[model samples]
Target: MLGPVRIAITFAMSLMTTLASAQEVGSQKTFPARDSLAALDDPSPDAADCLRGFAWQNAAFDVQLESDDATLRSVRFPSPLDTGNPINDRVTMKWYVAKDKDGNVLHRPAVLVAHESGSGMTVGRLVAKTLSLYGVHAFLIHLPHYGDRRDRSIKPENQDVVTTMRQAVVDVRRGRDAIAVLPDVDTSYIGLQGTSLGGFVAALAGSLDGGFDKVYITLAGGDFHSLLVNGTNEAAKMRQKLADAGYSGDKLKQLVQQVEPLRIAHRLTPEQTWMFTGSEDKVVPFANAMALAKAAKISAEHHVIVPANHYSAILYFPTIIDLIVRESLPADVIPAALKSDS
Candidate 1:
């Protein structure tokens, strides 16, 4: 027979383990669906001040769709960043097809969604489903060794943080072209979106050549090295992961610096790039967001501030998705005032 105090302690420990598993499983599985978005309002002109200016060539790759652990169809494509292993070189993306009121699929503007660091792709899937339901097609891309990209055949599919970041940028940039060529996709315009960890990668990717017509970044900010060193929650976990992998102190600083967005952010088309950040995000402090905004030279209206924290930003998705559609869709799709003026 156990005393009441011992029973209480045991219960508390069990609860803590359950919570930790829940937090970690996001990368392992997609959660069940959430409430649908309200009927979309007429496409309205938004505060975006930039225009797509370049015509860069999209990369070429072989692609195929196959069944996966998720609810939607899973697609695999050759990533531009290769590690010599055929299974390891391919990237994974979840296809969330858009449909009209009658349930018929629609060809529309597409957004390649980069997920947060959870590896569960919770935020990515949420945003993708919402966008698809709201009319646009969204692809939830898994960064290297994430989701279906993992293969048991390859003993350790994981790359170092720096290598992973570089590969993520390569995969994302190549994904724009890959998504464009898919059937039922309207190639007239394509958008790039990233949240948190994904946002940092997207920032540098869009900077490389401006291949994407529209860029949307959420819950991420600049000075990545400092963020990793001092940031709480996700950042802290990342630091621990790196330390466990033999990256500590100045070595960790050196690794994160290679992927810092500030170095290449100036290349982003400020007018066409929009940043959505949470005001109370402790993981990515407000000052860091401002640092990125400054580096990218993003216009005032393009930098949107949400009245929530990093974890709580999900609560504001209805409002955020509306803005994303207005910001990323083609001219005929939304006819924004900025597009009209240009």
Candidate 2:
């Protein structure tokens, strides 16, 4: 029923809308490739200063612990990034304990779990529960601006990305110290495991010191600039925000280089490191995962490739958890529950 002129105008408006949508989705065309970020792997003068600023002279701290169940305890500590910001200056943990055949508590190997970005606290708890079933005590630490640590003044999305990462590194390292001092944990067999965002933070934290006997990183990779610029989902959102703030090209690279895990990845021994990545991951990109693996000197066998994409990588959690248990715990110490019936 519309006239020719009205029909033409309507079509033009639709065409413009389609073009705008395409532009938003294709904005990453100008971003750098994974190989171009090699400079991020090299050590810089600022690396030592960053490490020192986050280091704690002592592992001992005031811990308020409460029992949630026979096998789990809730713990709280003063945040390593404490700046008198009550909301951001405290850390919470869910500690899963190992037990003997008689239900008595036992001193056992421990792993510090770093959670993913969103809904990570729930995932962290699942990982802790699974690790406990394998006889390894697990400590899941909530990262800055996550779970109980969330603050209105510095929401995770609003804070400087590099600063949040640095704070995470400090927090994860301190978590290792906290677990090591626990009465029923074996200090000599401490390990680290992180999923996605947590995995990236764990990579940097593990590199800072040889505190952990093993490091298991899942669904995570390196080259911060490349991932932010070309990645999908949450990564895409981050890119748009940075671009709006006038951070692109070399300037954006410089900002992310401050917390690039590749810079200190060399400190991680290949023998003690393992990585799990999805082959179809667009959020993290396959090349980004390989970069982290190569920097850590991990062997091809140690690098696990899942058939699914980023979100679907959860399908392999059982297999991934089993692998981590086998690598992290002593042969004689693995619990019967984790043993294969075959």
Clashes of each: 4, 0
Models 1 onward score TM values of 0.76, 0.81
- Check candidate 1 and list the clashing pairs: 26-120, 27-119, 27-120, 50-271
lDDT of 1 at 314: 66
Clashing pairs in 2: none
Candidate 1: count of backbone clashes, pairs at least 3 residues apart or interchain: 4
Per-residue CA lDDT of model 1 for 218-262, tens digit only, reads 888888878878789988887787888888888877677667777
Q: What TM-score does model 2 achieve against the real structure?
A: 0.81
Model 1 worst lDDT window (10 residues): 46-55
Tens-place lDDT per residue, model 2, 273-335, is 889999999999999999999988999888989898988887667666777667677778765
**RMSD to true structure for each model, in Å:** 13.3, 16.1
lDDT of 2 at 128: 71
Runs in model 2 deviating more than 4 A are 1-60, 100-102, 152-154, 340-342
lDDT of 2 at 52: 54
Q: Which ten contiguous residues of candidate 2 have the minimum total lDDT?
A: 29-38
